[model samples]
Target: MQKEEFIAIASKVSEGLATDQQKQLFLYHLGTFAKENPEWEKLDLGFRQQIEDEIKSDIRIQVFGEAKWKPKTTRLWPRIVAIAAAVAFIILGVYFFNYRNDKHLDIDNLVMQGVGPGKNGATLTLADGKKILLSDAVKGQLANEAGVSISKTEDGQVVYKVVGVRANEAGKNNTMTTARGEQWVLELPDGTRVWLNSASSLTYPAFFAKTGSRKVELTGEAYFAVAKDKLHQFIVKTKGQDVEVLGTHFNINAYPEEESVKTTLFEGRVKVSPFYTQGEALSEGEKATVLKPGEQSVLANNTIKVLPANTEQALAWKNGYFMFENENIKSIMREVSRWYDVDVIYQGNVEQKTIEGTVSKFKNVSTVLEMLESTKVVKFKINGKQIVVMPGKDNN
Candidate 1:
């Protein structure tokens, strides 16, 4: 197309005033011209100059219309001209996609916008076989269990420390359990650390014996940061699968309700497999899903899929947040009930809707439920510790 014709069509497109036929012709010609002149094909000088002058005139008109008075002095004109030049440069930069790359997206802002605190209430089982209500406990040391000192930190973290244990017997078994709406942090004798999620328990030794590998069994989800012990590996067992690691940070989701146990490796290497099968080793940024025997990992159709671990999303609970991305109502409620020590009852077909957002667990349960209700997809009514979710009439 001629330069004048191309400029006219481009300007129309830029102003969102192009007709349907004009748009189609403009797109076709633009594609053909781009393909033919792959180099830095310059616009016709006359055409470019005309557009530039038009842009300047448009700016001047806008400023004159908005200003209290017309430009009178040459000095003010220079300032206005400079401002227009800056704006024009910015417009050109955006038009050319100069700053559209991932690097310029401000990832920190994105993360902050999406992160929310996790639910913080849980039931605790004392060593004496007594169940203690922990959701409202003071943020400090709560008790001593089986010679292990248990304390609630100021930040609401349940911490465990072994007392009066000989260094030689450090690998002897000790246990810590938390019920729904609770979480705990345990520091292993070997300097490894574990953050247990609600309804999760961990069994480990008070001290490291240095004779065998450091091993622990988990019943629910947990985030682990293993201290490097090249001589001795660290092992975690959950249900039928086992994870072996030398030293690394990773998250394991082995909820009984979940169809598959997922082991997401954030750093270093981990070997994951069922107790009976010969499993393979996975490196950093990989996830191993332990499917039932005879079942294979099918990316296309498998309901139980292993996904690349977004550390912030996977470990948000441990970091005090509830994060969801396009999660179904059923899954979201399951998490809510576990952390709030409540029971979820679906009065109708509530799982048909999907939600995507983040909310603070520190907020009142009703507030969180109300926010979900604002989506107009579902309605929830709270009765004591049970929540009934029903499909809203207007949801569809």
Candidate 2:
């Protein structure tokens, strides 16, 4: 294909107006022409110049001050979007693959820009403690455990469909566990929807039958959209406390490594048991505190600390982005460690700085870490599976 033909195809691809046949032809031409002439890879110079002009003027700027990056309270998409938009036209309609071919980007290449995010896979433990790997299970009815029909979908979700005869009969309990760098969604027998994050596990009855109330034990973080069962209260039990609600949308962060367990309510009301009195978290015989929508209850120091919740931040993992706001390097690294399945080792005092940005969780580990390094607050050295974080020049 000629340069003019390639430009026309790129315009259509960028605008998302190409037909299925047109898209195929465009891709075929790209493979052939791009291989023969490297200069014609991205849009010709004429088209790129136009995009560059549009980007510089309208793109929102999020500034990083000094070697020690300053605190930021800025939006994410408006910043790098112009550049991403420009590249979308050139790179086969990839949405957020913000890549650059530069000598300074050697680390990026080592990390392999194609290293994408984790997907759904988990271990399902039956009442008999039989651990079944869901990834190995076929896409269909997995089993009929305790009269509940368990099935796996192509989209990577486990669904429990309650049978008619045993609708009120209690089935054996089951547990779903996702290790580091894994995630899985579950649709409980009670119709509740759960999005489980990495390094988390949940245990519940196979059937909600004949129970006084619905209860589940959680050992990690999860977002719940409870199905409204007015007669049956939904209670989530953690090491710290129990979150009881009728029907609500909420997120719970109860990782054992963290200092406290946080329950952020997005809709309806929830009662956090063993309510706090003050700064303490692990006190005995605490009372229950009711939290309204948009409030978060932090179980720490033997008390329930209530604060306003950022709903978007709580749901970022499920939405496929790493959203940070006034978060320190150590806290952010902990999350990266789980999602990327890498061990984090700190060097010097790297937690002195804060980061505020949004990047694609689906990107390679290098891209995600590079986003932080861009702020100049921290530097990372990849040593096999372990990442050592060091302080930036200003902090030194």
RMSD of each: 19.3, 12.0
Question: Whole-model Cα lDDT per candidate?
Answer: 0.57, 0.70
lDDT of 2 by residue, 186-219 (tens): 8998899888899999999998876578989899
- TM-score for model 2? 0.70
Off by over 4 Å in 2: 1-115, 167-169, 275-286
lDDT value, residue 117 of candidate 1: 25
On a 0 to 100 scale, what is the lDDT of residue 259 in model 2? 85
Which residue segments of model 1 deviate by more than 4 Å? 1-171, 277-306, 394-396
Structural similarity to truth (TM-score) of each candidate: 0.57, 0.70
